[model samples]
Target: MSSQFELLTTRRFLPFFLTQALGAFNDNIFKNSLMLLMAFTAASNLPMSTDILMNLAAGLFILPFFLFSASAGELADNMEKSRIIRWVKLAEILLMSFAAIAFYYELYMVLLGLLFLMGTQSAFFGPVKYAILPSLVNEEELIGANALVEMGTFVAILLGTIGAGLLMGLEQTLFAVSCVLVGTSIAGYLSARKVPAVPMENEAKPYKWQPVRQTKQAMRICFEQRPIYLSILAISWFWFLGAGYLTQFPNFAKNSLGGDSSVVTVLLCAFTIGVAVGSMLCERLSGHKIELGIVPIGSIGLTVFGIDLYFATPANVGDQILAAGAFFEQAYAWRVLIDLSLIGIFGGFFIVPLYALLQQRAKPQERARVISANNIFNALFMVGSAFSGIVLLGVMELSIPEYFLVLAVFNAVVAVYVYSQMPEFVLRFVIWMLGHSMYRVTHEDLNNIPDEGAALIVCNHVSYVDAMLLAGACRRPIRFVMDEGIFKNPALGWLFKLAKTIPICAKAKNEETFENAFKQIKAELDDGNVVCIFPEGKLTRSGDINPFKKGVERILEETPVPVVPMAIQGLWGSFFSHHGSGIFKSGKRFWSKVKIVASEPVAATSANAEMLQDKVQQLRGEYQ
Candidate 1:
């Protein structure tokens, strides 16, 4: 049977997607039109000069992120998100109004003012725009939603950039620009109106005038979660690295590919599509959790492809390269396109999860504040990216692909450092690798697994490979509550520890170990992590099954959330089950496979010792 992608079909995503796409298109259209006007036509006609005005326009646009982003984030939290978006869109309309007037009257200063106002609108809208997703999307849908947003934005920008370039290059560029702005503004306003209202989370927080002071306080609170800080740094640094490449790609195409702006467009398209593909696939790749393994893989791609592009590229393929169309004919040029596209693809895989992770994991009360803090770092990195680009390409005179090589190596080095410090990323990486390498397993009704706030997985005891199989199928990384003896097995010890597996023993089995194990599992689930335990507490030596223990209920009394019953199927004779030697003493390294049947989720109330065992036995009936 085919699956309908529910996330993409939802109303919550569609309206916002269109609104953002229109806004991006509008921004690029006007910005590109203005660039053409000032660079060629306006400059030629001006009595004094146009470069100063152009520079002022650029500064005006970016300045709002620094001034208004913090306030915007707070506003989104304090008021309805959809309403705030509407107001932001209204402001965009007003900004475009001013632009229309400026274009008609030839008022350059007025145009610059509109640009500044545009920046202001974007600033206030930025935080709410990204931070609102966790509330709107299911945890599993985050990756898909984010990917769509990004992809749509890029598509709009690409189209707008091309449209603006063509129309603005005409003799009556201002009128063409004015027409584009008016249409885009109209489209934006209509889309914003269609957006459904989502109520504010923070209803009572005081809104005061001390923006700087409040921002600092918010930043202080956000960094309290160290992993959050690391994530911020990683994300910010990506923008920094990406900004250089983005800014330079046009020049790189012109200089190396011996092509014009059309090649630049192709490069942009490839990269954008790559990101779109990457972002959309993130939901599937990471299995709906924030899998940091992809970050390493992305980093590696950034470095490796970057280096390859440098070597594969021959300098000055032609002294005077023809238009962009001819470059495609060269097989060598295709490499650059593929490289950029993959870089973007990997970049999406790296970024989307981290963004979702921040939203889902950050304290709900301070979510907007954390988002604002992220904005601060983002602004810093983007600004820094401008300088980095200049330093690497201009001052150092490094070739374009060589810059790519440098960025790639830098990504690898930084990734290693980040993963080493917080081993969760590396741990997830190991799990990701193992799961992919293991037999293909289709996980359905995984929502049959709880999202958070404590959960115990009760599964029938099958074989040595039961936990591994179950862990692979689960969306969340489960802390397997296992017997100490099995945990201490030399062969799988590393895997267990990496999974953060907690080992428990019965008082009769090992008192100190049991107490320690209970304490650890209790703490883990209490903090809203998934904990899995086999009620049998050991592999069934008998071909049938083993009796249940009250240990599950005992743990639930301390940290109760949801108990999910999982059934291991088809493991009876797959080399590890009791069908042959029937014990761990047998040294049979056998390649075999089986299916895991995940039963419907059970509440802690229904998970008494007897009921839980009966439920699993039923699910495991024929397979076991």
Candidate 2:
């Protein structure tokens, strides 16, 4: 719904997108064509089995990520990124020329070698492509920009993969594939030439040449922050998961689904389309912010859908290979497609936030290097995944479906382990689920919340889940100050505790509780954390703004943090609000449209409970 496509018209982003997409397209075309040729045409002449050859091809392509990502990261950090991209694209053109020659001669070894060279080019280009985005786009546009890149990349991959397979089936296979690959490479180079220059970050820093030492240095940069390190690990695991699934698609279609090459194309198109759809949806779902909440949702969907795929797949299709149309005619085949598509959808959710977070949070000087570290780990994981699949399917003699089940189970374990390490991801997921399920929350001017340093958030409490909704809308973590009654509720208390929400009581009822609340607020603000308080003190019984309590003034007086006023609209009649007689006895407006309007920050000197309430009222308008 957002204007993500508009970025394509901009000089800063358009050329880069075209360059990246063209590269992906060429890579997939070459890889898929070679794999298809080996699997069918050259299987008899090749020394190795088709499966082994495919695995070897996959490993060879990824080898550069492990070997050169460190050096590439350094170069990206020290060199002008756009210029580096142009040079990389030129390398791509040369490599594709070699690939064209290999295809013409049908030189198997030469083709494999060219695959490695292509991988090398991509490895060098990866850091520059990702790291340059922060320079080209502002923070708010990062998610949308990444979304477009992701969509374009996968779509290009889809076209390349499908086109290669189709072209290889033609009479003049070598000539057709070569022409397309060479053209794509040249187009990529031209696009790279048009990319607007992005200023270098560490132009004077000496570039590292030693792969081993530089790789270690990149790892150190990644380990500099725990979240960043975890993100890299998570991203690597995604590649592991993706590699396992993608590598098995051809075999799965042939042996498992009892379908021919066309079915494999269906599987590829379905999954790729699903990923593109999911990536495009991220900008809307995240409210144009780098929301990590989608990570958990994606992980869960991936596990669930992955496990379901095993069940959806039958033990065997008939001995005869079914065409694409016939494959879809089978009732169970549709289910398999759905499972794979959902897996891709969830995969989109899992990776996008991590990428955005890495870009936004990593130190600018070392960001590209950190990305290289991520690439190295990703390659390692993917290669390891191939071996693991071989062991499970070959040595252990597990069926392909059984291997899928195993991967799904492993995914669940890994997701739980990661979330256990960082509960913030899960916390945000819970907040996101609450907001999305209960209301359609449209955020306006939510970026008014400061990115860093302490800030006091004053909002009118409209419902029981207002804090969760607010947390979901604003990118920052908020420690909500809730009334003692709600804080002590058994059902909701654990959530508040997990979020570290501050609980306060009426001064006359419990002076100690009230006093401790202010102390905690001061400590949090002093530590440069956001603290949110409902200055209205209690939910409005009349569906109108309640009078402001003096506690907000007292806390602001003590902390002197910038006060941001936010208003929640369209929740008054909901089940969570104090409509009719009590909560849940009133209207149950499931997925009711709501809005969160955040006004500009009021200076601590000018801020008061009454004035903040007035600002919230103005923002809320007649929605309540």
Candidate 3:
């Protein structure tokens, strides 16, 4: 649990974290300060209303992501990342110094231009921000690293927003805001200088300035991997939902909650703090692994609380608007705050792993470009969220609560479509639930299995859920060879199929099915996959090791891959095991302590059925 925090004490991660967090903080401070200025003092003198000016400002900030992300990606990939961070932070310092002048003179137009420059700086930083994590940390630490970054980002956003309000409240608003923005920029640049350089693996290519052509090339690189592309889309959708909620908060607070600006701040705090909490929780919840299982859990919480928020809203406002303290005194207000907070918390769960996965899975050479494409999509989705809010709350005449309900329903639709396209998410969720709920699973020596390349795992058969338990324990995805009867079990068929488990039968029963199963096993191994087989072929009714079958020997003869022997203990009497009258006939035990142990891998030539069985039996020992 403390592993994620330990990263902050090290030179590799801490400086980078501070650099990024400060960057986010500065962006929000400047943006929010400008918005506050327009809404309060500059509104009367502006050619357009405050609302239009605010929207225009938002567009100007995000426009750089659309126009310059491709070029940014190219630069990040071609140059050293730490140098890029330093340069970007230096640009921020220069821009913020200009911003100080703009603030001092109340030069609103210059401030707007500075905002665009700030966005441009961020656009360049985006790719390097995420792409550098893998180079800085180990594979196991990637999730924890991402969790901290996500948490820091939301916290910075919250503080920056609040800081803007505080600065604007001062008598010397211009001096205070200018000093704070410029000071933060300088601090950010100093931190960026401490970030260690991460050199590109391949030779640097020539930089191209064509945004349209480079963007298309980046998108092509993004789409080259289905999982990475889907991850990008999912991340983009989260931004859409986030943008929708954030854009409507002030109006919703004013019209529905009957509250002043302070109440809007409260809502913002609840949501932002929730995200920070949730993000930090990801490392612990995932056991420091990039666990995709919790993603669905996050999505479920998001939709559930999103709909609850709509229900929690008051039907009408009182004659007098309430202050923050008065709003908290109301029962429904608490419900609304809790709903927003939980939505933010779940949002943390939803997003951290996807980013980690994108970093872990993308081709190292193209990683920055893939992240750049993700940035473009995020900007587009956020802009779409603004328009969707206009149409739903304005043209369609839907109340804010009604609009929230719409967003919740749409989230469900998007989640279903995304999961359907990539059943891997749902599959991981199922495995994750089993470990967290049904069993308190512990693993020993799982590192005996190779991190990559082909391998075979042989374990004792103990329960109907052994395959799942094994899948949950191992880091890499495994292709399990299961008895056809269990594979076709009506209750767990979909899970088995989703896992791509190969179904086999005794040759005497079905020669073709048996032969095909071997073919599939060989194919999976040939493709560098981990394949696990319960060599005993059936569950143990007597809580003892069953005799190993010859099928394992046959598969090994063909594939000749490394064979890792494993053992499962303490599951014999569980509901899914055959320790009772039959399967599913015994009293169910919740949170049963289960242990899986793996032995060193044996060469294919030395891995016979009897020898592997002896190794598994030795590992199991007296645990059963």
lDDT of each: 0.76, 0.88, 0.92
Instruction: Residues 427-532, candidate 3: write the lDDT tens digits.
Output: 9999999999889999999999999999999999988889999998899999999999999999999999999999999999999999999999999999999999
Clashes of each: 1, 0, 0
Backbone clash total, candidate 3: 0
Global Cα lDDT for candidate 1: 0.76
Query: Top model by lDDT, which number?
Result: 3
Model 3 lDDT at residue 527: 99
Error of 2 at 275 (Å): 1.6
How would you encode candidate 1's per-residue C-alpha lDDT over 2-51 as one tens digit per residue? 11156556687777888888988898888777766777767866545676
Q: Write the per-residue lDDT of candidate 2 for residues 1-624, one digit (tens) a residue.
A: 257788888998999999999999999999989998998788887777887888789889999999999999998998888889999999988988988998888888789989999999999999988899999898878998998888899999999888877897799999999999999999999989999887767756666489999889999999879989899989989899988888788889998999997898899888888888888888888877899889999999989999999999997678888999999889899899999999988888888888999999898988899899999899889879989988999999998888889999999999998898877788888888887786787888988999999999988888888888888888777889999898888877878777888899899999999999999999999999999999888888888999999888888888898999889989988877877885556366656788899999999999887788789899889889
Candidate 2 has what TM-score? 0.91
Off by over 4 Å in 3: 584-591
**What lDDT score goes with residue 497 in model 1?**
75
The window of 10 residues in a row where model 1 has the poorest summed lDDT is 1-10
Scored by TM-score, the top model is 3
